[model samples]
Target: MHLFAMLRLILLGTTLLFSLITLGLAANLVDKLGDQWSFPGFAVAVSVLTILAVVPMIVIDLLRRGALMSWVVVELPIMGILWVLWLSSAALSTSVGLFLGDCSSFSFDSALESLCRQYSALQAFSWLNWLLVKTYVIVTLALAILALMKGHKRVWFSPVSDLSFSPTHTHSGEPKIPPPATAPGGYNPDPRMAHNHSASPSSGYPPNQPPTLYSPPSGQYPPQQQPYQSPYPNQGPAQYGSPVQTYQSPPPHAAQV
Candidate 1:
């Protein structure tokens, strides 16, 4: 019991730690957004929208709520935001539209001097940090998301009091009860199916279908008997070339009699 409690605590701590880190990244991204805004083209538009969507979700993840924290509640949105940042960064390369004067021709000292002109302190600065910094930031953001996903998940309840728990299913090492039969949840019924489906497999009729009378295929009926004929004397031998004859006639049940 203590071992389980320890594992859960570790998971909770990791989840919260990732949340804090992602929060920091979100703020940094928001600040960097301003630097990218002046760039022309559609990537800027996408970058703006992505940053806008990401910041609030990160804030929500950082903010405390009454409900218990879970993967979907706290980490799912942050992971999605990280993916968006990955994609948007590709679309908006750091080299474009920052108005950073070309430092290619400047010597190391000359470049540092230009920084004063741009930032009211030096002559210039090198943008070599642009690629490496963004790459590092993205990698950390991805790791935080990964750690959040790897953390243990707890039920939305107070941990103080508990009875025995019998789980029907487990996902990612976490015990879970199967969803309610008819609820709109992970185990929900298909929307295209009928509502009155039978709960028992031994039902008389197929589930969701009304009872139907079975019909045999054409030509599958039993063989029918023909009427019996009586062999009697030919009254007149109408053709005159045939003999008049009389014979014993069998009864209806006489075939075996």
Candidate 2:
């Protein structure tokens, strides 16, 4: 556990004990006096409220302390309210002359002296509880302010017990960096340059290798293409007309021999 957390628990335990004591003394006085005074009743009320509030918080700190359970938003307000309550109770007791005179002044009557001592005790414990709460609240607020200045904005909603008042890092304790882009065969490629080997020269691809031509896959041949025929053909002579008759020459030379 953190040192702050342990200290906080110790303070809470002490405050709870003080509140219980104050409650007992106040209740006893109120029962004996029977509404003759209002401060004792107010003290009883404050003590009851303190007990009711502190018990649940102690349980939370013990069993279910977490970001949500121990959130600053939740815890600080309760502490501040209790601090005010205890302060008011203590101030009221003092202003009502509960701690005005020495207990021995009432020595003429044993009962009066005992009651005076109890009143003094009640006032003392109320002040003590107020001091405890005030100290815790001031420390917590100071740490919160430090955390904010240090850029731990999440600490406002984070568990009080887990605050470090510093910038938190990843689990590995190093700043997170993105993985480099990689190509096949474990080749790390520069992100500023394209990885396409066949990209044009203007496209910023490296000119180390000449561009290759597209070819059919290995072990596979292209399908044979049929011969092309013209859509228009020449007309045949028989389709045009019959052959023209040729002029006949008689064999006149055989008669002369």
Candidate 3:
């Protein structure tokens, strides 16, 4: 898109330069010819040509940012103004082209012929003045029409960047996942899964043995055994009992003796 925009910028600059040159030459020609429409025509031409000069730069800049509407907004008026410029200049230059083309054939006073053929500064010898004006006029008209069309902008020069109205991401993001369907009694919808889900000890564990709520007698996890206690009475702890001190009582016979 930037490439396209840049190309458009280049085209615009080229057109702008052509337009400036044409405006200058045509204005000079009108001035030298001393035609009746020269004053007002040049006035409009100057103002419109200023717009022609300035707006393309603005449009090209706007295009880089993908401001299509903004570009259209400024460019629509530019197109309209260009239409006026084109038509006005076309009429003026076409008349001049005809005059210059036929001036030699027509029989007129020497002074009148001289005036008609007069070119003050590089008007006749440098290049064809009417041709430049006419070319610029046609170019302006073509660009104007192209600007008004929606698809033409992209086709003319592909913009490297652009704005889009459509959403880039889904509106609600990730889709919601539903719970798996169940049977009439809330069993799994699938028979195999339901069977696996309802495994029992008497029924035996499922062969694949997927996770389930039913506990079987130890297919994978064995029940832990508790240590057995000895049932004999002598088996209890006696080492830690208090030491009994038995006093040897003097025998009664000894005491009596």
Candidate 4:
């Protein structure tokens, strides 16, 4: 995921850089070529080029965070604008060429007169320009609304703006877990079970048996008097307080005690 995120960031930055370069080239071209319909047509082309370039970045962002609907809300109108601009530019260029052909050799005054005379031709051009500008304005405003609606204030009109609509974390505001508390040696004996090492005399095993591990001595002994020895001689002598003890008693006085 980290590598994928880094890839996304690289792609997004590259897209922004490319968009700026294209825009700079567009500005220089517009200045050099003058502000004819062709210049605006180039502007439309640059916008479309920018939009196409960033689409992959937007798709990756959407897939990473599941923001598909938000993506649509922002991108659909921009696509519509591009379509209108390209379509209108082509149609209007053809219409103008046809309209001027009839008065091709006319003077400026005569051309103006002919232009005014052909109201249908004038109206066609007007409608095409209107649609082009109208689409631009509408798409721009829709993008603005989408950005605000998704709480992305910094990326309203930018070329790579769609990458900003990240999804809210589904696990946000959940409680965190602390590490498990442990005692020395990574062992945490339960307080209730910490002091239960004493042996019960009612069981066949004598109190002298080891607390954990035990084995009989190698010496031969009667089956009824199996050998037993104190496991913790350092603690104290073992007690033989009940009848369960079957071994030969140590000393009469010691056994009585």
Candidate 5:
């Protein structure tokens, strides 16, 4: 469990880093492009769009992965995306304020300038951000729509718990189906009923065997026929230091009547 938690933490950290980088790039693009580029508000919209688009998919993916901490994994990506969006918004607002000369101009460090300058060189970076955001939105909506249309299917990738848990017939609050019936010619095995039956001839039986039939002695009157014949009459009962033939009989007077 501890190991699972640690793994979840690591995945969370990675997602956070991914979000931070995505937002950082977007912000830098906005800073360089300026408000005159005519799509200044697009980055904020895209950031929002990305969050709405990716979160549920990430949740579903984590669930499908069978993560022990799946909820945590889902939440981490969501929080990361939100953080990125928030950061991007802050950065864009600051840049816009500077552009309008309504706020104090902050000098960029060498690294910050380098990053912004990289984005500025591409007149297409602003469009690229919008494109990415739109693509994410479209794909996510398609997936969600597909899910709704399918109406909770029993997909192999889906969790077994989500599939049909209802019993077709119930017994004792569990699905009821008689245990597979014994094979037709097979012995009924019961350990506690206590009979010594063996699997091989050396072990007093043979594979796929039928029990040996006992033959009556030549002049023993063929034993009196009992009113009730035993199903396993060939299997004699232990008696008098030897096996004896036994069968069920009616009470004596009742039989005579």
Candidate 6:
């Protein structure tokens, strides 16, 4: 069990014990007094109500079941009601003259003194029960507020004992899965290429026996080449094999003579 849960159980059990004590004393006082006063009867009623309500809640909490009554939304209101009841019972008991007066000073009879002591005990337990209820309510409310502020909106619907107030803890949303490895320009590399890149040189094809290149199937051949054409269409082709003619300078001198 959680530390918080265990503490809650202990506090609840103590409150339950106090409620039982208050119930017994109030019932006995009511029987002896016979409805002469209304406070004792009120105390008896509140104690019975507390016992009936708290017993089932304690059982559910002990079982750690996710029942409707165990939810914070439901439990808070129930606890608030009980808090008010205990406070009223305590206040009414305090108002009685017997609770305030000294039992030994006033009562000469031993039985009457004992009865006065019971009234004092009853009043004390009623206040103690109210204080216990108040403490639980305040602590629960503070935890709920802290959880809400930390983005745990669903905490209101969840069991108080099961919740953690740590800022690092998350109650909702799925765990994020990281995206696949990507290259520059948003390209995802092929798994095979990545494997090859990471593989040891000795594990792959030998350095001399490189991987084979793709070839055409069976009898297919490349097409024949076409003849080349000159860019200047009007120019004649040069005669490279013919000899060059010599210049006739003597014919010009013969003409002058």
Error of 2 at 176 (Å): 10
Show the colliding residue pairs in model 3.
1-159, 1-160, 2-160, 4-158
Model 3 C-alpha lDDT versus the unseen true structure: 0.46
Which candidate tops TM-score? 6
Q: Cα RMSDs of all predictions?
A: 19.8, 14.5, 17.2, 17.3, 17.2, 14.3
- Tens digit per residue, CA lDDT, model 6, 46-161: 99888887887789866767787788888888888999999998898888776455787757688788778878888899999999999988888888877776667677888867
After superposing candidate 2 on the true structure, give the runs of residues whose Cα lies further than 4 Å from its correct spot.
165-257
Q: Point out where model 5 deviates above 4 Å.
A: 1-20, 38-41, 52-221, 225-257
Report the lDDT tens digits of candidate 1 across residue range 193-242: 43443454433343466667679897899778898875654465366667
Residues 159-230, candidate 2: write the lDDT tens digits. Answer: 777654344444443433456766555655455454453364434323454556689887699778899986
How much is 57 displaced in model 3, in angstroms?
4.5
lDDT of 2: 0.78
Q: Report the lDDT tens digits of candidate 5 across residue range 119-227.
A: 4322233334434433333433344334334543323233212223221333232334455445455644444322454443333343466668788778977656759
Question: 240 in model 1: Cα distance from truth in Å?
Answer: 99
Q: What local lDDT score does residue 239 receive in model 3, on the 0 to 100 scale? A: 65
Q: Candidate 4: deviation at residue 67, Å?
A: 10
- For candidate 4, what is the lDDT? 0.46
What lDDT does candidate 4 reach at residue 178? Answer: 38
Which residue pairs in candidate 6 have backbone atoms (N, alpha carbon, C) closer than 3 angstroms, thus clashing?
none
Better of 2 and 3 by TM-score: 2
